[model samples]
Target: MGASKIGSYPCEEIVVDIVVQKSEKIFGELDVPPSKLYTQFATALALLAEGKSTLKQPLRTKDTLAILRAVENMGATVKRTQEQLSIWGVGRSLRPTGNVIDVKNSATGIAMMTAIAALSPRVSVITGDAQLRARPMPHLLKVLNNMGLKAYSTKPDDSPPLVVLGGDVRGGRISVRGMNPSLIPALLIPCPYAKKKVEFLSCGDSLQLNLALDVMKAANVKVSVGKKLSIPNQPYRPFNLRVPSDLSAAAPFVVAAVLTDSKLKLNGTDLASDRGAVLLNILKKIDVKVEVSNKFVLVRGPQQPRGTKLDLSLTPELLPIVAVLAAMAKGRTTISGASEARTMKSDRISAIAHGLRKMGVKISERKDGLIVEGQAKIKGGEVDGCNDHAVVAALVTAGLFADDKTIVRNRAEALQTSYSRFISAFQELGAHVGYAE
Candidate 1:
């Protein structure tokens, strides 16, 4: 016997039983909203800063709300209204509200805030929901522990429900696997206040590190990149910036525009920021005709998506919908360099492959990547969301050209994880997307 096929996937894809209705075309004009990651980062950075900062037109979704709550517990002043978010940074003066900071189901929230909590002189327990607990706590714990934060978990598996006995973070040189893109920045969030310079060596050598480093650079953290990042003692400077639209959220619509005979306008996004920039670059590389302006990204897709090898190493969030787009594109599409996606909120790699396989697309799975053979027609069948948001969105995008009815199970609610306006946006674009009540 080789290996048990039981629980060895990059993630656990629990099949849900749902259906998709076909649409003749896609068209819409909507502001593709600001980055939740940026919004959440503003909260964290604000809490770590010396003054107040405002996040304009930020996404106040479940995930960002989770981060807000965690920081609020850590004494970050957050006042929310319909238009903007205000964070009053108490800097290193923050004290833990309780012994535990519950990040709900957000891994990014918990992981990013965990490092901040470790800077406190009091012991703080950072934990989250079942999905969050199941995800890895990232390999950064060893460095944090060595840095005088004393981070640990009962399972000792580097996953969550972690307890960090606080002390002065004597920041020193540490090495990390860059595959978990969030981990590097998470560790760095509080390092500026640490007693010493925090140097980082990328053990995994993932190229995604640049994105995280850009985020840090935006926050005014001095990160010198080489074989190791030499970060000196720095101050958290106040930043007044606009958060750009999310590229991860922009993917399905981009796919919708390309696969259907409709034009879609993504407002408030110019393809200049991280998630949005990365996705648009990939789309451009594949010869998708998208016009990027200062205020909005004008995209009209009805052209057959051409096949190309996409490396999703830095942007693992694109794995699901990218796979869906690849399935419908012309020729063969190869996606590589995203092995870490195996352990996202779900194992996205296996989930995308499994879902596509249901709708009659030929897919070959590797430990880290996937190969999709583009077909002229999308066959009608059922697929599972694997209870993952990315999987759900991927399956939904694939359903636009699906013959007759296509069902996606265990994913309707996961839409709130990222975009609450997903179905409505598609519906506005003339797609037959709705709830199955």
Candidate 2:
């Protein structure tokens, strides 16, 4: 895929120049977009199904477009309308184009596409842009090889430009015990197409892991879960469903509202699923006032916001912004079980710590997470986005609460990977945010 193709989406550019200033008052109301995770997972499952699948209100960002193209290259036919996108699946009859599939900066996209490609009895090469190429896929590739694909990384460290010769799943039993939760979906999604019944050992559970199972169940794929997880060889039936609002995308705005003591209402976000549940649980620990209706989430700043401990093992992506929220709280906040974040687009743990320290925050970076002594006020300074979208968003939220101006540097790329309208959304709320190249 070419840069021109990736940049063709209507969303904001991947690289953005962003600046934020402390705001005394800001207010807004907007709907959070669909979940990128759900969009990607459902798209992959649809590709494996036997008939047409309808995905309503699926997100159409540059990152997600990569997944769409990758699936098209793997024998799925897609038709887009104003209201929904229709996909005619290949019915477990995997076809590989053999052309190198480009996933751009989407980690989940590349992981799911690689697994889907392995079902085809042909050669497939998976690669991504510079930022994504730096992240390794050794665990995924190694597990795929064991499941009958000749998977390996082009580089020694097991980074992208991954090459796999698949369609030989000699499936009887395999163990994905202690594997990274993010990569487990890569194994489970393709197991049903194996030559024999597939049984797994040590397939741990997480929000994402359960979410994958949810998507599978929706597609009419049966996987018996017990002391051991097992999937009989079968084909996926087509599914139709609307993707839920993305809680990850709504996090920045939620944090901004909390830090600025402003009222914010987010429509279309559910408080019961995915990262939404995680965010809701985290908010209860703090002193914020949140009202949840059937259709929207309303948040108000607390008179005396305080910090508490958090375990981000299942929701590591929340660590960055949560760290910022911790800084603004009234007590010590300990965040643990997010060591996997070190291998993301950037070392988020290090990036957030360094950026907060620049803003005069009392914080300590630990191997697995961070320990922060919350302060009532902090001086604003320049912080680096480290080319990660979540880090950029987190720093921007931090800037909104800082005592003065905050400039987020190295936000030159990957800002739109998840939340393309982050800056625009804040601006609509009357926040003092702008572009500063």
Indicate which candidate wins on TM-score: 2
RMSD of each: 7.5, 4.6
How many pairs collide in each candidate, listed in order?
Answer: 11, 0
Tell me the tens digit of each residue's lDDT in model 1 across 161-188: 8988877788787767443666665777
Model 2: per-residue Cα lDDT at residue 184: 80
Best by lDDT: 2
Task: State each model's CA lDDT, in order.
Answer: 0.74, 0.79
Q: After best superposition, candidate 2 residue 367: deviation in angstroms?
A: 1.3
**Model 2 ranges off by over 4 Å:** 1-10
